[model samples]
Target: MSVIREGKVKRVLEDPESSQHVIIEFTNFVTAGDGAKKEELEGKGRLACDITEFLLQYLSDKGIETHYVETLEGPKIRCFRAAILPVEVVCRNVAAGSFCRRYGIDRGIELSEPLVEFFLKDDKLGDPLITEEAVMRLQLVNRSDIGFMKSIALSVNHYLSELFAQQNLRLVDFKLEFGRTADGRLVVADEISGDTMRIWNKEGESLDKDLFREDSGDLLSAYVGLLDILRKTDPKIIPIRSEEVHVMVMPKEGIKNPPGEVTRKGLIRLGFQDVKEVRVGKEFKIVLTRPLTSSLLKGLELMNIKLLTNPIAETHEVRLS
Candidate 1:
């Protein structure tokens, strides 16, 4: 077994049967603070592997070059061989963690724009921050390579952000690593999942590797939750009905959460007395292919009940618009 690199969370094994392929195995171990903190959680490996596998395929289908080939037995994957880079690309959307402590910025203060940073992937050096110019000057990666990595990093950021947002999760930040194939073709390497991302749900619940780092509750469960949400809500899932019809589910009567008196008064004070009340409700628009058969209509009704609206308080109407 040509096991080249074994990290705390994953290991790379060269496949004896395939020269151009390697087996990346996810381990149960979770590490943080440059490996200062560590623990082995049962089922962590499988959850991480599941999410990484889905995301690799997701990004690949979106035209991002990745080393992932296919999922193997259990928590393992067959991936293309690449000369791994020693730099970690960090992308941030909302301020948190080290960024807040180092820059004295308040937590959750959204950046005017997403910030991209580079760091050396050295535990001994504590993954010290590195400048793009330094990356080229030190001959680690040339300017062109740096630019390519940045572009890929930003692209992944965009896609992943949308991916999580679909499930009502905010991707605060993530770490990505890139590598070069034997022919020097740049491709995204390593795994992505809760371990590499800072995720927050619609209700602002922390649901990623931060649980382990911050001593939060049920680290493994959080990892599983992340994978579960992604798998259930991923557009790749079959029940998507994407190629067929457009089902718009709107409530027959809006929810009774109208604007407060102050809001109404403020609107009136602004010379908008014409607007007396504002009741807000949700409308779900799902696009699927045509030919909405009886069976499909039943499924849509089931969906409308299960995921769209509350039958007791709100009723929904599904229309092919």
Candidate 2:
């Protein structure tokens, strides 16, 4: 097979049997922080290939066009040849990781609505988020193509979110890439596995690349576990509806509130001397696929006390909807 191209974690080769197809080989190579950190884990490539195959097949069965044709030998797959786009599409269901850092919001805050974003696929520039206008101006993709990608990305997010929720895992966020075939058809290309997505268990533990990025857990073992989950997950399973749990954090009555007092003074100084008081509080909304049982509420309350508030000076209220 003649080589078509090579990337950090995978290589593409021309398929001798069909000129319209290519063979993609996943490598053990992994990187994080824009390739500032790197490592090779044994069996990681095969695990990635299997995970991608499972997900892409699920998507294709859902009537989404993808480059995936069939799984070949270990760590390899045959796919239709397409000119991969130079844009990365990201869909976020919750506030976490770079989303929190970028927006200065606390992690774990469930979004009121899912968000889709675009980034230039240039590693040299840290793949900074790009606007649709910028994408058009840069000629990276046309306006219509942007709309198509955004729509498909959201659809993928919806399906993947339901799939993971069934397995009791939260699909926090993921990145996707699309390409155009010789017939000018837009199809999802590249891999979708632990490396391309962020998944968290019910306890908010990372099951994706964050373990490798943060150096806090075993990457290979996590990937293996993810593969097992995907292998058993039924793409045709009915989706479980998620319930919204809202948590409100506020200062305890009679507690000294220096920040609140400052805000009150500022509001009064601006004009209204009748400004009586000001209180600052935080609100968090968490979505759960499981029933809101007493035990679950206890766990959430414990989490609030341990991580969401100062027990001595703050109180929290939990409500379900």
Candidate 3:
């Protein structure tokens, strides 16, 4: 595979046989604070691919234009050739992340409606915000392109916010990147995972990539939790089923204010200032009532999204023994 661009979490490679297509390979590599923090977390690639595939397909079904073709096995996907624009369209529904820090707004403050902003996608400059006029002035894209991007960004926030609300998650904010086709058509490109969006549960608890960015929980487990919630909305996400599958769900590390947290407070007051952090998660053993097979195992894995765990907040394992 000829390399096109290697990004923080994915690698883009030129498709050897097709001049008009490319292959995107997701990596388990995780980075935050713009490369200040990084890790090679196992299962990260598969989680990103699954979420991206589901969301891209969701947008396609909603009559939105996109470059998504289909997800292949593992962490790779195929797409039509297009040049990515060096701009990120951000949609915000709640006060959080850079929005709060930049404007000095309180975190979790709800916005009356969706808000759209533009940022130049330059890591060296820390992705500084740019005005629509700046975009046109720089000749990166014209005013028409900016309007189109904002329109679609808000549209996406509407669809996704409602979609997540059904699963009791609040869509706080998200980032989107677009690409222009050879024929001048702009379409949604790149992946949308927990890495790009900020999500909160119905109870106002952070559950998206913010967990990792804030050092409050395990990112891998949170990614798994999100995948679980999303898979419930799409039955076609996976098609494996048998009654004889066993699964185990557990909380990822770095969790804050777990059930164990309640116990630690009393200890601290008792002069045990040495008390450290307490993390807690759950474990469930699933037993099926049919013969075991690879297909069934896959089905059980898909079912995990429904209840076994939340891909946004937990990590799980599957085994027969």
Candidate 4:
């Protein structure tokens, strides 16, 4: 559990057996405006975990491949490892914050469509938002990737805006991080907690950011209230029942065969109270130039590799080969 990187409210660590990625540990200490100031709030981490877990499950169920993997040790959420992009996506549904201050827009005024903005990942530079041309000129990300990321971020805001409205909350604006997975899939990677979004109650009272910005003295209370609203809205929305399993494969000739040893550790590591273990085996690797889809069954049959396993009657299960 050695710390690999520490953020304002979370620390990331490499899983001992898996050198390819790390696990994030959300902390109770919250911060804004980079590391300018920090405050300790009791139960902040738990609330973040609970809320983020719910949103991640909901979004994933709706076909969003978020970085989330599972929750371990009750409150901690496990996620698939990724290489974070050096950009922060700020999706705004209304004019507020610096937008109102700098551009003289009225607060709470909704935009016709959600505006997707990008900020260079440098807090010391005051996180100035840049245009799409500047983003590509600076080479922060590939042009195509940036386009895809913006599309996904806007879609996420649309989905969340509606979801929060159901709970009588207005989704003003939020920040999101995207990362490339081991398989090169770009997915949302950061924790979507109260710290990252500006949520307002039906009465237009602030529920998230204002508590921190204005030092409202009821920061934790506001967070708990938001959680209470969520709980009442969907108490039965438990952690997702993961059906898909992932396995890391390498060339057998050059790499030392740790299949047996890795398999044992994986079994124990993945054996959560709710998860079940299935059989494991070895097979040759198949590389596809494009994305794999359900329509590619004929191509898969030609390859002669077992790609999937029979569904087990358990909450979760994994097989490594």
Candidate-wise lDDT, in order = 0.78, 0.86, 0.78, 0.70
TM-score of each: 0.72, 0.73, 0.72, 0.71
- Candidate 4 C-alpha lDDT tens digits along 97-147: 888987887889988988888888887898888887888888888765675
lDDT of 2 by residue, 1-321 (tens): 777887888999999999888999999999998889999999999999999999999887766688999999867999988998899999999998889999899989999888999988998899999998999998999765776677678778888988898899999999999987876678899999999999999999999999999998999999999999987788887443455567889999998888989999999989989989998888998876543433455678798978988898899877543
Question: For model 1, how does the per-residue alpha-carbon lDDT over 20-86 read when each residue is reduced to its tens digit?
Answer: 8889999999999978899988888999999999998888766677899999886899988998888
* Off by more than 4 A, model 4: 234-321
Alpha carbon lDDT at 227, candidate 3: 87
Candidate 4 residue 280 Cα shift, in angstroms, is 54
> Could you give me the TM-score of model 1 versus the true structure?
0.72
Clash tally for model 3: 12
**Which candidate has the top score in lDDT?**
2
Which 10 consecutive positions of candidate 3 have the poorest summed lDDT? 237-246
RMSD of each: 16.5, 15.6, 22.4, 17.2
In candidate 1, residue 212 scores what lDDT?
A: 82
Off by over 4 Å in 3: 234-321
